[model samples]
Target: MRLNPYGEDPVRLATSLTTSPPLTAEELTARCVGAGVVLEQAATADDLAEVNVFLGRWLRVVEASNPQARAALLNELLAESSAYPRLTDHAGDGWHIHYRDYGLPVARLLRALISVGTALHLTGRGMHRLSRCELTECRNPFADFSRGGQQRYCSPTCANRDAVRRHRAKRALAS
Candidate 1:
């Protein structure tokens, strides 16, 4: 069975939802579709609620202070969401491994996908790869997909903003 390219995308998707959550099931589904997730079932308000709950739990995993803590949290999520891996080309997009059982509701599918993807990302990259932005006032979480794995901000804007703030503060102190 081929593992889906669950490296960066699922983490990024989870980050996006946590940083700026969609308000409706349609919006959430649209965002998932936009991110190239295949949705075989109709999204509903219940799905939205479920996603919110799942993301909340996911955020706990993200905020875990150390590798052991993170791993434990992730393991719990994995147990809840995913199953033994299997291969499928249900979408016809390509043959890939699925960590979830077939015919799950959209909410459950997302939980499984995100949990497994986050596991792959952290273990494949580094345990410290996922983190909140370093910007003092902007604490959005992010996935470090940078070539150097040194990404510390959720966006370039936040990085630049913090940089400018630091520069001005330094100049003022120097003056």
Candidate 2:
């Protein structure tokens, strides 16, 4: 059975992009491909700029505090980059779903992918599951797929840093 391509992968890809944006079209395309996107067009500088704009808007959705506000923001993104859902086997990976039409530019593809993926990720997991790391110094956005649904830090490093800080604070309080 074909896995849902519109789920975790896109959200993770968006997080990665937001954390460290690509500097060039080549780098952007490489990152997308690395994240499981199959590109059909040659990426251009214009595409990179367009994607940066989309990412800016997407980051707003990530930073939104309330569910209603987040939904409104995401709906706006979907309206901007939406197409009729179509079934495609362009890559012969499998007969899967595409929320966009073929031949769209790379930026448009990314817009659609991120919008749909975020929606799926929130609904499938939980709306409260997506958040920035709780570590005061690291505000990286993360999609929590943890079994307990309590993930706060972006990675183990952040978790460790926070733990060390907490330990130091306790020791100081004892002194």
- Estimate TM-scores for all models: 0.95, 0.97
Per-residue accuracy of model 2 over 1-175 as CA lDDT, tens digit each:
9987888898999899989999999999999898889999767899999988898899888888999999999999988887878888899888988898789889999999989999988888888878899999999989899999999899999999999999999999999
For candidate 2, give the lDDT of residue 72: 94
The true-versus-predicted C-alpha distance at residue 95 of model 1, in Å, is 1.7
* lDDT of each residue in 1-175, candidate 1, tens digit only: 4446566788889999999999998898899998878888867999999999999999998899999999999999999999998878897867888888888888998998899999999988999998999999999999988889999898999999999999999999999
Cand. 2 TM to true fold: 0.97
Candidate 2 residue spans exceeding 4 A from truth: none
In candidate 2 the C-alpha lDDT for residue 71 amounts to 90
Cα RMSD (Å) per model? 1.6, 0.9
Model 2 clash count equals: 0
Worst 10 residues of 1 by lDDT: 1-10
- Cα lDDT, model 2, residue 39: 90
Backbone clash pairs in model 1 (N, Cα, C under 3 Å; residues 3+ apart or in different chains), count: 0
Supply the TM-score for candidate 1.
Answer: 0.95
